[model samples]
Structure formats: C-alpha cells, structure tokens
Target: MNPTQKMSLQAIDLVGPSQPLVSLIINNYNYAAFLAEAIDSCLNQTYPRIEVIVVDDGSQDGSPQIIESYGAKIIPVLKANGGQASAMNSGFSVSAGEIVIFLDADDYLIPNAVETIVARWQPETAQLHYRLTVVNTEGEAVGFCPSPGVQLATGTVWPILLKRGRYHSNVTSGNAFSRSALDKVLPIPETDFRIAADGYLVGAVPFWGSVAAIEEPLGCYRQHSSNAWSNSQSTEDPQKLVKRLRWALKHDLHRYYWIQHQAKALGHPTQENLGLRDYMHLIDRLASLRLDPEQHPFASDASAGIARKGIGAVWQQDCLSTGRKLALLGWFAIAGFMPSLFATPTIEWFLLPTSRPQFIQKTIRGIKSLRVA
Candidate 1:
C-alpha cells in the first residue's frame, strides 16, 4: 500500500481521530543565524504529528543556544564537532518516526512541505521514497536540482534517475525515506572527508529494497553564502574542488568495497556491491602508485584485496564521464583539484549562443508554424 492508502486506512481506524507521525531530522552545524528559520519552517508544518530532531555537531557558535530556545518541542542532540555525516548520523540515532526527512540548518522548509511529502510515503512497507521540490532563497520556482538517486527537472525525478543511475551524483541529503529504509543504511561512515557521504548512501540503498519516487517540491533549498556546496563553489580555488572530488571518490570507493565484502560474507550475490575484480583493480592501482604499504591508509592487508578491478570498473559505471571527464579527473589529482578551472569553461560553454538572433527567429518561426495537422 502507498502512503495515501495507508493514511486512508489510518484515518478509518481513527474514525476521524488523529494524524500519522512524521519525524523531521535537522542536521545542524555552525549556522546559528539561519538555524531558527530552518527550525521555524518545520514548526509551521501543516501536519501536526511532526517530531523535530536538531542534531548539533558541536557548533562553537551559539547554535546550541538557538536550538535550546525551542525548548522541548525541538529535540536537540548536542555533540562535539563531528563533520556533517556524524552529525546526521547522530540525528537519526534518536529519531522515532514512521518516516524520516532531513532539513539542513541553512535551508528552510516550505509550508506544508512535511504534509506534502508524508502524503506520498507508503506506511504499509519498510521503505518509502519521493522526489523533492527545489526552491531558491525566494519561494519561487526557479528550476530543478539534483539529489542522490533523485533529481528535479521541472518537477520530475524519473528522467534523471533513469539516465543518471540510482545514485544521485550531485545532491541527496534533502530527501525523504522510510525510517526502516534508513535503519538498514544507517550510521553513515564517520570519514574525515567533508563531502559526498549523501551520494554514497543513495548508491547503497538500492540493494536494500523497493525504492520509489514522487514529483513535488517537498522543501525549500536555501542558496546562500555559507552552504557547503553553495553557488559560490564555482569561484573557489580549482585545487580545493579537485581535493574535494578526490576525497568524494575515495569515500565512495570505500563504501563500494565494504558493501562488496558484506555481501560475500553473507553468501549473497555480489553484483549489487563490489566484486573480486573490483578488489583486484584497487590493488593494481595502489601498486601503480608504488606507495609504501606502511604509509598509506589503503595499504593494509585487510584493505588490499577489497576490490579487484582497475579503473575500468569505476570509469565504466561513472556516467559523469562526458568528453571532459578525463581532464576533470586530472584536475582533481594533478592540478590541485581547482573548481574554477573546470567551472569557468563549463559556464562559458553553456552561456555562449551560436547565433542568438537566428536562434530566436527560428524558435518564433517554429512556434508560428505549428498546425492542427
């Protein structure tokens, strides 16, 4: 049964009594200024059975105090600074709800966002999935954005999922899933890496069970100066972006290897996870580097045979490998991973018009030429 059917059944049980439960997990860090707005957005949800969890990863800033201002209504889990993944993990650790949703500290939720999303969640199953509505700082419909295994293009998720693959390579954090679906994929690895944990998690979920999608803007995406992957990311040093990409790759590789091992240990199939060839590939790549086994984190005997394939497996599956893939990967490794170097060209390429006037005339002519036949 889907969320609507489940809600309908529940409504029948209630005989016009009460509402279903929804747990909203907010992963907060140091954004004290924007914290209240994020929290308030949830508080104002049209759905009344919503429980809010604000996990604070030791903000030296006064974010903790801001959360405290909410008193008991907003459950606040305070902890030492543990990157975003750890903070998110902590948030889920304490959530008690049929479904789970994430609201970042810097972003606010649209009014009735929770109600809209929960309406689509299927309470009859252990898992639920849905598409999200992406909005800018102003509440207007700007365009679609990407999330793990989910992307928004004029309010559609199917095209991106089918074309891009199960894991959303671009964005994934602000999506909704059944708590049961989450428990199976919980405790996102506590890596020192600062990005891409959400992407890795999305990739891992398909193996768990029936994943689903819905077309609606479930929340508001705040685009501002302090967001981790902000609009200004294009202006950053190319080296920093490259470093971030490499780290993301490493983290994803680690998850793939681990999932592969878990599958083999349970005597299940390995196609969904890593394979023997995948482990071998990792070994050969490390050998090519000739790094001292004692010095590198990936050199341990335990980690050695994790995946046996070379770059072939990774590159083959990576869809982002357009013509520019190699050069971009090169930037990540050789050119200090500069984001600007890659972005400037991309921006210019997209902005350039072959012949603006001609294109406009053709477009107008085509529209005018449309006929009933």
Candidate 2:
C-alpha cells in the first residue's frame, strides 16, 4: 500500500469512533411562516453526522405541512398543543445524539453552526453558547445583542447562577448542550416554561459541568409583535411596554424558582440570593412602579430602593459595556429622583425601540454591531 494511504488509515483508526451525532431539534408552535427555513437550516448544517428533529406543538398553520414536506430528511414529532417545554421534552425523548441543540422555529442557523459547535466540544462541558443576530419578521437584520459582557460567562458558572440567577448565555437556538448535561435536567416543567423554555435549561445545565462560549453569531433570532416571548419587539405603545415589563417580571421569577430547586439538588445551595438584583429586572420593577404604582407587585419596592439596587447591579455587571452601564445609571437616577410623569415617558422611550427617533435606533443598532464584531 502507498505510505500516504496507509498513514491516513492509521490516523483514522487512532482518532477513535465516528464523529458524534448531533441532534438538532426545532420546536414550532404556529411559526409555520418560518418553519421551513428553520428545518432547512438544520438539514443543511455543515456537520455530516447530524439529525434534524422538528417538533410541532399543535401548530394550526402550515407547520405540519412543512414538516411533512421534509419527508425522510428529518424526524417529525406531532403532538397536541402543550407549549414550548412539552415540545422540548417530546423532541429530546426521541433524539439519540451525543450533542443536542434546540432551535426555535423562528430562528435559522448558519451553515457552519453545528460544525463549529462540534469542533469546540469538550468532554467536561455541559453546554456551549454563541451569539445570535436579531432579525425582523421578513428576515431582515434589525439589530444585534452582545453577550451580557465583553466576554461570555463560562466555566464553573453555577456560582454566578446562584447569586445573580443569570449568566452570559443566549436563548435556545444559540446553545448546543452535551447529552450528559441535558439528561440531568430534561422533562422541563411544561406549565412553568410554556414560553422561554430555554431560560430553565440555561440556568440548570451549567450546574452539571463547565460551560463554553463561541462568542460570535451562529444564527438569526427573529423578533416580532406576535412572538410568544415578545422581547425586543418594535412596538411603541406605552401600555404595551408596561404589560411587557410585567410579563418579564413573572418569567424572571419562574426562572429563579426553578433554578433554585436545581441548585439545591446538586448541593450547591445559594448562600445569598441575588435573583432580584438583576439590573434589567430592577429596571422592570422601577418602570412598573412609575407606570402603574397601584398594581406594582413589590410592596416594599420604592423607586429609591430599586435605584440603589440597580446602581449596584449596573456597577458590577460583567456582561454589559461601559456605555450601557452609564446609560442604565442615568436611567436609574431619573427614575429615582425625577417626577413619575417625567420618568415614565423617559422609561418608555428606552424600553420601546419604536418610541425612539429613527436615528437613535440606528445609532444603537450600529453600536451593538461592534460588540459582535
């Protein structure tokens, strides 16, 4: 045999088993508009050893048809409307890959996404995270979201999760989790996670092992008003902003309650809980207080208390840029010291992208692009 051919065969043998199969699970619920693109992205991943599983959560639209159209190219899970968590549980039960990724139907991965995650895989890692480009309903780039800081929060991040109840991690589509990590926390409580199912997983997975980060965009996260989780929508209505803050508050609380249980089970109980110390949550609290003081949830939550805690949060935030910190600091001050009537409008301006002047939105989007760059 030729020496080169023999060496190649020997190298193959030394490299051990075939590449691990990656299960790309796409969860859909009335996202038929974008379902096909999401499935195509998974099927077309650069990684050769991968399986695409599409879970339709009783989508009434064309989602089932799209899934059917994929034929044998993908595995299909059709079930009654059970929300995001149920769909996730259903999908993973049938999956057989060493690496697993849950891609949202409204999102699509770049060709190299799975290939890159597989290349970066480590035996000790529980999960790997990457950034995502924010896009509109029409698939147009609308903005970018940076990691919570200059560098992603990685490695033994349970302590961060314990104190702050959050870390630098992206939504569902931006993460590829080890099967070992997922096994520990699967069957996510359906009712608790009907929306933002990724939040529970993101918090629970890091406790099992070290986490990793890719630090660049791997997919597109489409945002629109009709989204199940309407974060970063382009709506300008004042009442809608108030309603969103309330929804965010509830979601954050659910995340904390669930993660706390996961942590205690692992013997990593939090000595001091900083769950409410989150800057964004505080912003939500402060804004809610101003917008509708009568219905504000926290009884002891005064504007001053929120501002003080928010200042501390912003100061210690490892994920945000200095400019962002400064802006938040100024916001807290206004919300704390200014009259409610004045601060309410200002808060809405910051919270709603459509409320801002076009130039300002363009400028902010431009600045955020540098973070991903």
lDDT digits (tens) for residues 1-373 of candidate 2: 9999999999997665668899999999998888989999988888888999999999998889989998999999999999999999999999999999999999999999998998899899899988888898888986554534456778899888777778877888888899988999988989888888998999889889999998889999888766845554457666777787788888888888878888789777564445467777788889988888888877777888888888988888777776566677888998877997778767877787568877766765555444422
lDDT for model 2 comes to 0.84
lDDT of 1 by residue, 277-359 (tens): 34223433332222223433343433223322333433444433232234323222321223445434332222222223565
Question: Stretches of candidate 2 above 4 Å error?
Answer: 1-7, 13-16, 147-150, 271-273, 358-373
Task: Compare the candidates by TM-score and give the number of the best one.
Answer: 2
Cα-based TM-score, every candidate? 0.63, 0.92
Error of 2 at 1 (Å): 4.6
> What do the candidate models score in CA lDDT, each in turn?
0.55, 0.84
Model 1 accuracy (lDDT, Cα) = 0.55
For candidate 2, what is the total of clashing residue pairs? 2
- Candidate 1: Cα lDDT at 306: 30
The TM-score of predicted model 1 comes to 0.63
